[model samples]
Target: MKSLRNLLLGAGILLLGSCNQAPVSAPAEPAPVDKAAIVLENIMTRASVRSFTAEPVSRETLQTIVRAGLQAPSAMNKQDWEVRVVDSQDKINAICDIMKKANPNAQDRFPDKNSFGNAAALIFIANEVSDQPGAFSAVDAALLAENIVLAAHAMDLGACIQAGPLRSMESAEAQAWLKSLGFSENYQPMLVIPIGHPDQEVTAGQRDASKAKFVE
Candidate 1:
């Protein structure tokens, strides 16, 4: 019986070894590293532009940016976010007027006048208060907003994220503006981002590896 057991164990190991040595399908070869580097370089070159052409971003591109923003990480996988896109010249100008009045010296302080421009469209990122705790909601909004910025950049579009305009008012007009856009009671405006093609060239900033901290 002991001999028989030893023989069975030996046979099992041999079978396992044979299986391990058998040809196994491998994953598809990845794209060239240089291709990836070029793609990243293109994305990095994208920058915020205060001046934009008169052209408007197509609905498709706008949708793509919103979809990307929606893909951002959320607490507990609960993605409770809303985006309000302002494209009409009237609406854009109205908001711009409000911003201008809110900060008379805005252009002087922020010479970029980056808050709003000829950029064909604007987007407001909001989060539902009930979806998270006080600060958590803002954090979620921020993550999603960054996604919008990066995605826009990837598409060769320019984006500027601003918190100033939205914070100015709990004014009835402001509430009405948001409510008109179908924002639920829980959705609070967090930030506004303007989108467009850059009129002036934007330079990419170098990445500093030293800023990253890693733990083994």
Candidate 2:
């Protein structure tokens, strides 16, 4: 009976000791994300790419980039624009041919030889050519184009904003290709962005600080 009492007392002492122990501390929270700096860095570091690897950009990624572009602010929120993403090698080749054909009559259109950067895809931003649009369509489309290139840069993809395509798109030889977009007689091409995995690393051009002045 005495031995049994001793064992019971030891067990009780152990239980009390266990209860007296300090509680476990909770885990530290993860660091808050500094998205502002990241965005600023992206803007500051983004450079226009001239060449691209043969690796094809997935349609999903293109869609995501275009979706990001759609977030741009529009005049009166008209958002009257259409995006055509061309990733097909065959179609892309055809378009390249068309670009060359259209520029043939021009005074100085890459006179030596033609080069299209061999990009994985071309994203054409077209704004509606409406007589009475509720707001400024060109400005809205331009804003969206800015959003697109920035988003592509953020995703590690490179893009070049080419206004040169505007002339090509308006050429007679481009009618067939434009018709294929199903936007015949209504939309006008504003900008075409070629995007892909960058093969060439271009340095950012120097900014004219004098152009930007401190206002009182």
Candidate 3:
């Protein structure tokens, strides 16, 4: 009987030791990121970049920016907008020449005759006149234009919207050039977006909050 009691006590001690052993655990996952906050921060930090490096923007990046522009809201869901992406230096130079010819004094108004920062590409937003009236189409194009710039900024690319190029498209020669760039005669260029890797840093200007009055 003494030997049996000793054996039982030894078994109890081993069981207690096993119970006290540390448990095996699975690896922990990373914390969830706040996507909305990230997007809002991107919007706040966006600035108009007028100067750019010589590095060209890739086709994939340009397509992504265009996708973002198409995601913008349009009037009556008509989506009356067309985009023309011009990346060729020759084509850009031709357009710039037309601009200069259209307005001989454009140089005085703009720092560069191109007014596009000599970006890797130029995105021209035009209205699809058949789908909507000119006034409504213009508003729709403006919304799309903002989306394009914001998308470019989000992707660490610089972009600027200049009226000089679009305004120059009003001339007869400029209109002919537009047709050569694949824009239809019915479509009217509303905005010109120049995109590339930025060469200079830009700071946001101050806004007057008082100018915005809440009716409610």
Cα RMSD, each candidate:
15.3, 8.5, 10.3
Model 2's TM-score against the true structure: 0.79
How well is each residue in 98-185 modelled by candidate 1, as lDDT tens digits?
A: 6566666656333554347677898988887763344466777889998898888888888888887677645666556667677777
Q: Which stretches of candidate 2 lie over 4 Å from their true place?
A: 1-27, 104-114, 131-134
Candidate 3: where is the Cα deviation over 4 Å?
1-27, 108-114, 130-135
Model 2, 1-216: lDDT tens digits are 999999999999999999999888998899999999999999999998857888999999999999999999998888888888888877877877787676666543233322557889888888888778465788888999999999999999999888876666666667678668665467887888889998887777779889988899
Global fold similarity of model 3 (TM-score) = 0.79
Each candidate structure's count of clashing pairs: 0, 0, 0
Model 1 error, position 188 (Å): 0.9
Candidate 3 structure quality by residue, lDDT tens digits, 50-139: 777779998999999999999989978878798889899789878778777777876632365355777899998998766533448877
By lDDT, is 1 or 3 better? 3
- TM-scores for every predicted model: 0.71, 0.79, 0.79
- Model 3, residue 161: C-alpha shift (Å): 1.8
lDDT, each prediction? 0.77, 0.83, 0.83
Window of ten residues with lowest summed lDDT in model 3: 106-115
- Candidate 2: the clashing residue pairs are none
> On a 0 to 1 TM-score scale, where does candidate 1 land against the true structure?
0.71
